[model samples]
Target: QGKNKKVIILCSVLAVVVLAVVAYMIFKPEEKLAVSTVEVTKQTINETLDTTGTVSTASEQSFTLMNKVKVKTVNVKEGDVVKAGDVLATFDVSSLETALNEKENNYEKALAAYNKAKNSSSSASGKISSTKKQIAELEKEIETLKAKTSTTKPSSTKSDSGVKVSDDLVKRFIKIAKRFGVEYDEATARRVLTSILSAGSSTSDISGLLDNLGTIAGGSGSFDMSAFAQMSGGSSALINAEMSLVQLKAQLATLELQSNDTYLSVYKTVYENAQSEYQKALTQTNEMKKGWIASEKGLVSEVNIKVGETVETQTVVDGKDVDISSIISSISSGIDVSKMISSFFGSDKVGIKVLNYPLVADISLSKYDVLDVSVNQEVSVKSANNEIHEGRVSYVGAVATSTGSSLDLNSIMSGGGSSSTIPAQVTIEDGDKSFIVGTDVDISIITDTQENALVVPVEAIIIDGSDVYVYAYNKDKSTAVKKKVTLGISNDTYYQVLSGVSEGDVLIKNTSGLEDGAKVKLK
Candidate 1:
């Protein structure tokens, strides 16, 4: 009975204690809590693409040397202003001097040969003149003899037998005598009767001759008897004289022809040959002299060999020696110096210049974000040093590359495939030399903005995908109500409200412990 009474007393005491605790929980007044609220705001938002690139220069030039000779001097340094005809370097000319001497000796030999050929021609011409004068004197003597012989002869037409007078011959003699002007017309009749008895022609033949006399007399009008006698008497003497003159003239002509063939023709050949040889020698000498002068003038810009360095006259292209002056001219004039120097020296110079200010940056963007980037767009860059610069986007690569692969969620979340990009040129309106090229930077592009925006804290709004809701506190600060809200542009900290929320409303921010229409205390 005592045990039972103890258990019963314990149970009654526990019940009274629980009832007192429940009465205290149910009857206690709610305490007032201070809470902060934000009104819904409307604003603008922006989307942009970001990329990076490096800067480079505009122009450059390089110089190289041609021949392998000692470096006599380097007239121009890297930054020197070299004109077209500037004296750059010089080489020893002792070898060219020896070549010039040999050419001069050859020219002298040609001149001597030409002089010898000229003298031989003058001697032959004098001999030909003297021979022609002798022939002219002989022809004059023959003419005088022919005149005397023709005057002494009178009708002396006998054969080589030299038979004398017959009556027929006497008659012909009288005719010849009259025709030869040896007798007058009256003397002719007496000479004819005398010739008839002397030549012993019959009377009948004499009568025939008299009958034909009229026919023969027809040609007697212009006849000169003395000239005919002279012609008959001197015919052989005149022929002999003409033959002698012809022989002398032929000898003189032959001598002149031989002189022309031997001296004029041969000497002309020799003179032409000598002139050609002398011209060749003079050309070689002039070349050597010019080469020496060029070496002295320091026109050769560079030489690879030392003072005792041995080098062959190497054929640059199929037996052509290197022309040092042409190379120097090409280099000084900015011609094809690279190819010329390369052919001579077997190497080329690479020249590059960095003209514009260059800035390099590494940037990453999403495929959807690539469209907003382009060349020459203004960008706000924040450097690693926390310094900010205003620049224009100069370039954006069309392809995307990986940043890195990592096991972290943030790294995996950033991993992506190929993303299209636009390169933009950004000109820094203010030149800032402190920003070094190749520096990585953070960029944000402002796509949109709004003034006097009615905004609320992002945390105060509840978002289930696209559906958004907010817990509005009632006037009593207890019993908060859930209200659906229309939203607008948003940033990291604030959300723009388009509708369903107004100014001065106390919206619930931490709705984790609250239910729809549930009693809520603001703190």
Candidate 2:
């Protein structure tokens, strides 16, 4: 009976245990991850940056006139395409003629002054150089005289010696004459004395003139020849003094003549100064009139002036103000680029704009992309119509520029806070023969290229601090295996796997919640 009861209990326990196992099996399930996968392939991987840019052929052509003048006739209007050297308008030169005439008048005036400054040919013809030297010496002497005058005022013209015609006496007389605005050489002074002696008929005329000659000695003090006569003691003494007076009068005449002759040199100097002034005025005016006119094969973009319109002393044209002073110095081409019309009679007042064709594609790139780009690197441009043109990098900016497209580094890289870019240009091969002018297109610059490289989707790559990894799917284990990787070049879509990942490896595309060993079901 006991053995039979134990057997029943064991059977009941076995059944309960079986029921518990079945319940647990029904409720509990194995964990798995739903993931996407990409095949690692070996192919040529091209590292490229995608960017947008405007396709432009050439810059706008401008034509303008710089000077202020009247328009005589209008030869062309806007939208008229003309060849180089074509006359588009004529100007009224009346104002220009007047200006030239004024300048010429100034020049003539200077010449007239210069001519007048010429020392009288008859007066100082042979003594021109000597006369100039003499004048300079006199100027120094006059300065010395001024210094002397500052110390003392001359009280009298009397020499240390009595009124005798000696060297000292003559010197004193000359000093006195200079004070009175008369001077003479020694030879001339002696001739004057001899002439005075010859002219005097008697002492009576000499005596008569003595009272009138009170101021003749020219110092602060007056000389009275009458006093000399009184000193002579009697009639014979008076006669002697009268004879000396005649000699003095002759010397004074000679001194007066010498002093008057020096003025011719001063006139010559004044004329020379005037001549220089006139020449400068003439040169400046003539240079301003030698205006530059524009000539090129271009269309007449716009016309600002009408026939017979007098150019304002200052006027605004094409949003720019024109002025005479500034125009004279900086306008070497003689064209104010803002305005299209020039003015001058018999001179062409029209300006023709210049334009050229551009044979290159201009693009802008982000800083990272530009770092790998260099001049002469190969580039390929694709048009909207899928037309491709091969070219090379003609230029690459060394520094970044703000004039880049709105979409930049931020668009490609998450957490990329920068949008700064660098500008680049590419010259199309075959002279743009396959492309139309002003066509918008996509440009790809080849930064790095690899052949038969293992490439995988960029999404497959994962990052942990100081560790780069990818969730590589192992077919045998039916699991995603996190494998550290070394990477090379990359583009928008894929990365060139250098190592730690191999060709034919299935890479997990969705790395969310993935770790080193995770069970994954790839669909």
Which candidate tops lDDT?
A: 2
Model 1 agreement with the true structure over 167-247: per-residue lDDT tens digits:
554556457546435553544444433333233334454444433432223322122233222222233445345434534
lDDT of 1: 0.48
RMSD, every candidate, angstroms: 32.0, 17.6
Q: How well is each residue in 13-107 modelled by candidate 2, as lDDT tens digits?
A: 99999999999999986588999898899998888766555565444444344345666666767656556556666665546656545435544
lDDT of each: 0.48, 0.55
C-alpha TM-scores of all predictions:
0.36, 0.39
| Local error of candidate 1 at residue 197 (angstroms) | 93
lDDT of residue 395 for candidate 2: 79
